[model samples]
Target: MVTGLTLNLFDFQEKAVMQLLDLTTDSRCKQTIVVKSPTGSGKTIILIGFVDEYLNKVNSNTAIVWLCPGKGDLEEQSRQKMMKVAPHRTTQNLFDALRNGFPSESTTFINWELVTKKGNTAIKDSERKNLYDRIAEAHRSGMDFIVIIDEEHSNNTAKAKDIIDHFSAKNIIRVSATAVENKRYEFYEIDELDVIDEGLITKALYVNEGIEDNVEITDDYEYLLDLADAKRKAIAARYQEVLPEGKVIRPLALIQFPNGQPETIRAVERKLESMGYTYDNGMVSIWMSEDKRDLPENLTENDAQPVFLLMKQAISTGWDCPRAKILVKLREGMSEQFEIQTIGRIRRMPEAKHYDDDLLDFCSVYTFDEKYKAGLLATMDKAYETRRLFLKPKCKTFTLEKEYRDLDFDGLGEREVLNRIYDALVEKYHLTSDKQRNRMILAGNGYVIGDEILGQALHGVFVRTDMVAEATSYYGTRKRVDTHKHGMQLLHSTDAIKTAIGLSTGKVKTILERLFRKGGNPKKKLLALNTAEFYAFVINNEHLLRDEFRKITSGMSQQLGLTLEPKKGVFHIPEQDFFKYDPGVKEEIEYLSNAYQEYTSGYATSLVRSISEQLFEQYCESRDDIEWVYKNGDTGQQYFSIVYLDALRHQWLFYADYIVMKKDGTVWVIETKGGESKGKDKNIDPQIENKFNAFKSYAAKHGLHWGFVRDKDNRLYINNTEFAIDMADDHWKPISLVF
Candidate 1:
């Protein structure tokens, strides 16, 4: 029963198509399907889903054509790549239909310029070029073209409608990973929670999203990616297979902003050339628009299609590309339309019954630091049809604090309360930081910046409000309830949020930070650390987490006869106290706990001391250091609760699950957060992260060794490092977070 299905951990396209199929209930109405996914979620695959549906059967051999905004070598190459990425089973089935002359079943990807550009055949070698005329004539031929507008939207409707006229397609399929709908075409949403359960796609979907006022660059990208070994392998495999060896590809990336971008492709091209990579021999060519370089009047496919890249302010819509494998975002985020245009270039082919393994097979993307400016990822999620980036922080999104208070607790469905509260606090309220984000309120219906505005808004919401007070002092804070029970409360209340949508927060320190720049300083050139130390930091903090687990469930702890204690930040778990539980439960928990013990932390019933020692041994590899300690938990007796886990601090002192000798004078100092509940009224318990940051500051003030990091938008980048963005996608956040 739900009309729209929620997204799943996997099988994105399958979920979408199934959602679309549900529309069969309204068989009487001819509906234009509008799908909203990120730039790489595979909308093309969904478009192909209709190649032949047995339930709502639409039969025809001549109803398919593709459209796009450009006619360049890259565009054509993109088309070829798509054909190869389609799922094998579906492609085989579609291939059989294509043999029958069915437009949907038939396969063909051509350049719009090839069909739209007209030349005077009347004269042997026309003195003048009628390239535009040739293209028109081609369209007038009325061939079997089932129109699949790859980048269909208000901006490219003219071209799309024209193609629609020519094909008289039995079925019109518009596939855009980033779709901006002029009209809310019939929507087909998926069951997000059951994405993996359905088993329609592979490896589940992953996503990471947020809207940083002005994004910064950082080294977090490399670190986080390292953990996702399987994903990285898949990406490497796909890249290796597509780009031919000795192709001089160097695996580069590019980003394009709608406007307001400082650097142009030409500028980058010059830089690349200066970098000694300008010797193009057919394989390395850039595409240009309106400025046609048609092989000097005589060119052969084998003779290198001029081996040149094309530069266009904007690519045409309804374009087709099969070889658009790896899209790189080198540009900044300016407007949703422009962002969509860039991502649209590579999302042309669908994985219907026609081209298996080749349809929507785009595996990975490379993005420069700057593409995240102005909350690009979040904005695009609202427009696109094939991708998703969780618009919230991972930990917060998974936390279910508010439900504990409301009687209905209904246990807060996994995706509902947690996703709602966290996504809003992090994305809309900007609660992760101490500063309030500056929203440059874009004007007009197109959401373009620097345009004259009748009026403007921020975060796409709010009428008349500003910074609001939170916690210790007045700063823009997220929704909070002054409750004593929940450790995850905010200083700001839902009531406060309701009273002042836009004006209240203007008075907080968050607003002041946004209004005034702090005294700046530059500090670079730091010592390099490896991955082992990082794991050590996490392992050492294990006790804090277990203790918090204890605090939140003391009753259950007592019932289970479980008592926990921390030695050197490592918790001890008892064994005899464990096996006393239900046989199945004991086995499962033990299995998971033992695996953790073999590596890091563990939790047991009565044998807390022994279990803790064993887990510590596992983490330390039988070393004397207690999980590579900072302050001995056994000595202090005085300790703060673990409320927050500052991701960056641990990153700085990256001691791995492995070991190393304390190099005479080369020990890294990293800060950590006490893992206590944020508490009732302070929805955001930033104290933990703040302490870590403070620790870094102390180290900096004393000329010591330490750094800081805060996890936002699933991944993090540093400041002063922004890039022009073609597009940003969080399509893989969900899958990764789950595993």
Candidate 2:
């Protein structure tokens, strides 16, 4: 019945649920278990699955108390998800449960603030009596209780901890993305990489390059706003490009102000209005104290009208909006530190796919305070469990090569091959003697064919050689012919071929003999042959063979279908590890020295490193020899990394910048350097030289060309060649000159 639950859970989620259940059920395990899962990791679904499984398996009379932060719409959302999983069970809120006693099969969702408040405002005398009475009744009735704390980090205050301790539940399961450690509980940390690898969230974060080490707010407020606007426009453009036809999605931006003061709110609002953002026009929605706009229950839900949401720390926790791709923080002071909950608001991908564009693949944040930026980066590093820009390579490159050799076809033409096949079939079917036929008949009736009977029947047959070799290799068997005999006996014993032919083995054997005889034609040897004749005459009929063999030997020929053809003797080369080098590489290389003019192509670009790299990209576009030039960070561009060992034997992964493919099927792996260059050294930096060597080695192994280009003073260096070739002066050269 637990398997009947309709929640679509990822592997990690299911594992988390199972772990909680195991700890709860085992008497030796700890009573309190903490599950640490990141935001957007579907913690609610896991909880639902766990609760449903526990109730259905352990005790139907068990009660669950789910505690969430604040009195917001999250309680309702949690209740709805729980009901979907266990419709037959009852779900109620704490306020409702205060009036009605706890039901036998029910879950109660309570706000943490309700019980954590001080004095009479906490639980009224009547409410306290109701809760205690329900607890007493449940204990008397031999019912179990479970308390689940959601976002446990937020409610770690002394009052909250006291409220959790007040509940006399059998088990406590705490869940949070950023869990604070406590000595009273056992902790389980879910790998953040698992979530990112599963494509449940984005892999990296991208911020504006203009943010400096120390920023002045008064001087850069307008510029910060403009940068935020540009980021929003870029996100919107990307959404338009990748969204399905006829479907529209308006990306939202969250602007977190410093505080909720009226003066500050009004000032920010006036500035936004001048920038064409007004609540009257539906361009902006406010969630501050002064202007509490009636927003949708879930802002991430489709059809929400706000393009910009202005707030001051209200929707940071217990809120999810996948369309929120941009964040603009107007920092007033150092009071606001970057927290994991703040980053989680925009970490989720709306459709769970990055659309292969850097703009869409990353979440951007724009802030004016330098200290706030540093704190945010540090918090992200801790939350994601990553060091500074720890890159995991996502692409691999392979090339195709050819090898020439003489193929041995056994010196046989088509007709001769058919003759050899016929001979092999005759020996395989035991048509050489009557004793062999009797042995096959006995084996078909479930009698084991011993070694002597097998050796006599399969003495001259090589038809089963390949199968015997493969079976012996897989099973580590030395008696190869024993495998063959067992195969033949199993095949003949099944009713598959007999049922299809609707004839007895004696008659089928007679037909097979006439069909496989030396240069024999079925029409001449017997009545005119029909379509079904080959169904039984073919010794290697895969369907009949597999069905028959499976009855005796399990898991044999399960993947092989009904058509089993004889193995040919041709020496054909397989595609694996075959790399092809271009034969016309000399004519395809072009040198441009005098005709270098920057050309702009109407292609969307992002994360450009320098002006020279941009100009190099333009020059690559203008050349006729270049089939396609992929700039780094472009959508659908190939990205790859190579691992090289340093002198100390430490492994380092280096990513290539550009991949250029020529029309004649040649590829160049290029790394562009753009800074003030050391003039004509002809000696690349040792580290860079090591990477170049690694790249060249990988390219040669994969049959791809490799190059290192220096875009300084409008000159290019192919590999380590000493020629200072200009893109403006055009000429042809051999790619081998650099190699």
Alpha carbon lDDT of each predicted model: 0.30, 0.54
If scored against the real structure, what TM-score would every candidate get?
0.30, 0.48
Q: After superposing candidate 2, which stretches have Cα over 4 Å from the reference?
A: 1-6, 119-123, 181-183, 212-220, 294-298, 369-739
List, residue by residue over 1-739, the lDDT tens digit for candidate 2: 1343446678887787778878898888778787777777788988988888788887777888899977346777799877776687689998777777567668899887776656736588777767777767777877778999887655555556545555678898988776644444667777766776667676655544344433333323355667777887888887788788877677788888767656556666777788898888777888875666856555666446777888886566677788887777764432244443566777787877556776776776665332222111211112211111111122123222311112321122223323333343344444433444644653464444332211110111111111211221111111222332233333453334444322345544444445423235543131122323222223324344333322222111121222212122221111121111222122333222111111123221222134445555656756677655544432221224565433222234456666666777686767765423445433333446455565666677677776766554555535433223332223212323452
The top-ranked prediction according to lDDT is 2
lDDT for model 2, on a 0 to 1 scale? 0.54
Model 1 Cα lDDT, one tens digit per residue, 121-206: 32223311232243343346544444555544432433333445544543455544344343225544433223312322222111
lDDT of 1 at 597: 28
Model 1: lowest-lDDT 10 consecutive positions? 462-471
User: After superposition, which runs of candidate 1 have C-alpha atoms over 4 Å from their true positions?
Assistant: 1-10, 19-26, 54-62, 65-147, 154-171, 180-184, 190-251, 255-285, 289-739
